[model samples]
Target: MQVDSDPDWSALLIRVRDHEDKAAFALLFRHFAPRIKAFLRKSGASDTLAEECAQEVMATVWHKAHLFDPSRASVATWVFTIARNRRIDALRKARRPEPEDLPWGPEAEPEQSEALELRQETARLGEALRQLPEKQRALIERAYFGDLSHTEIADETGLPLGTIKSRIRLALERLRHQMS
Candidate 1:
């Protein structure tokens, strides 16, 4: 079959979203799966790990296609983002500490005052995060909670690496000021 080098991805995503169109999904899978696999491999995942992550990413796209927002991100960016998140999650799970063989023990609890202070600090940080600009907050969340590198963020956001770094740096400075 002849392939359109520049297919209209937004249209395909709409089809996937509105009608659960398998043909549109097939087109997306054909185009993005190998790219996602390559991206995972470049990030240091093994071939088998990359393949599994790529499959999971595509499956997520099929299931979550309705969540796609073309105004916010192109289809490739969205797919790569899913792939990136999946890879990070897989790595985190693989690195989880193994449970010890010893029997469970009742560990000492923290002091009530210390626990209250920690909770207060968490609340403050949450408020500060809420006060940030939408773009800034999104960058912060993607970098910290999403575990995406600057390069990956740039790719997914379709921004320059320098822009991503600068925004993150400025956002961090603002957060520090707000916290203080």
Candidate 2:
């Protein structure tokens, strides 16, 4: 069959969407499936993964054909966009830690001595923070405690970016020295 000679893909998709026409769906599958697989492989999916994801993408195209907007995109564009999103989802799923690999049950509590040491360190850090010059202390609090970026702090305080960075750097150096 001449698969690439300008068939009305959008019309076929509409048939799949509205009439659930098997002939139209077969035509779309024949035309787009291999292209989707090749696209996935080019985007760095392994052969097996590409093949699997291509099948899934085509299935999605079949099921979601009603969502297709010919005015917004051609059928090829819609199909490839689904293929791309499926690849991204597959990559994310592959990267996720398997449930079997995770540590089970509640975490062990810290030893009493370790807890005491942590409290002491916290006290020292608090004292050091209190001893900092108000300007430096305020910047450090805004950055580390308030969870604001230097740019955000600058916007809030109307300080130059350089001044915010410098004060934070100096404050960190002093804290490091005190901690050590």
Candidate 3:
């Protein structure tokens, strides 16, 4: 059996800087892909989309790692920023205008386009929201998605009002942590 080596980010980064080290790229991909996927999923991407985003992010790392500045951000932060940008691009891709088989007036068309964009963005956000535990996720979905008030959520879910508030607060905290 082959032993897996621990990631040596600084050394791997040096190799990446040389522009010839596929091994370094491999090592970096191995270590960071899961985190990227988790981040995207928390941000509201589905599993498949998050996986694709992770791949795109790593590909970017391979190309742009040479430009990386450790002084600006840690390796984790750098890799995740790449992941975040790629995720935004992927969300944008999903929000393209649909071909109108027939013209439905400019007014209707713009509204439809905006709705599609909102749906794509909401899905991405929901995916991230879903990464939270059932309690936290439910709190968020009820408050925002279902338009429930804190009292309403507490009543509907049979959770204490304080518990509902706390869960929502914690979920936002977790999301903020993952994002930055």
Candidate 4:
């Protein structure tokens, strides 16, 4: 009897992609589905959501099989990346307010005193931001106002990821002190 200790996952995936082989897809699903569910659960999804997302991710794998490039990523890496992106999408969808939750009429404007207070606070924040060292201030602006992730900031600045995080943290601390 030939032992099937290590089946070639890449070959199976290629079969699914090129030939649309049901047997190969079955093998891939059997191997990856449960692991994907467990990963989603560990990433803070409830059991039901994890199971649903896992199913959807596997379906995605089947549908998007042709897009998978073995040279760029292993089969496991591609599947897990799909799962992670699905989780992020699900979280974003869940956080969005429903249409019914939105106010219907024109929103009321703030009172003059409240608007003045907000302007003063904004000015104070601007001054505090300016007080930070230029390097730290730039990082803060990229991370907050620019809406860039630390990794993206690192890539753009050609700095190490740890340095980006540390500068952002120190800048936040200084801003807090100034605001208080």
Clashing pairs in 2: none
lDDT of 3 by residue, 1-180 (tens): 001233446457758877668888788878898888877776668899889888888888877876664434446556756765675577655433435545335452234445334434434454566678887886675664343568976787788998888878899998876544
RMSD of each: 15.3, 22.7, 15.3, 20.2
TM-scores, all candidates, are 0.50, 0.49, 0.48, 0.50
lDDT of 2 by residue, 1-180 (tens): 122345767778889999999999999999999988887775567899889988899899989987775545567667867876676677655433324633533645334454335445555776788889999997775663343568978997999999999998999899989989
Kindly give the stretch of ten consecutive residues in candidate 1 with the minimal lDDT sum: 109-118
Per-residue alpha-carbon lDDT of candidate 1 for residues 1-180, written as tens digits (9 for 90 to 100): 112335767678879999999999999989999988877776668899989888989999989987775544567667867776686677765433435745534644334455334445545676788989999988887775445788988998899999999988899999899778
Residue-level error in angstroms, candidate 3, position 164: 11
TM-score between model 1 and native: 0.50
Q: Rate the local accuracy (lDDT) of all candidates.
A: 0.75, 0.75, 0.67, 0.75
The global Cα lDDT (0 to 1) of model 3 is 0.67
- Clash tally, candidates in order: 0, 0, 5, 0
lDDT of 4 by residue, 44-158 (tens): 6789998999999999998999877554455776786787678668755543332453453354533445433444554567678888999999887666433357897789789
Comparing 1 with 3 on lDDT, the higher-scoring candidate is 1
**Best by the lDDT measure:** 1
Highest-scoring model, TM-score = 1
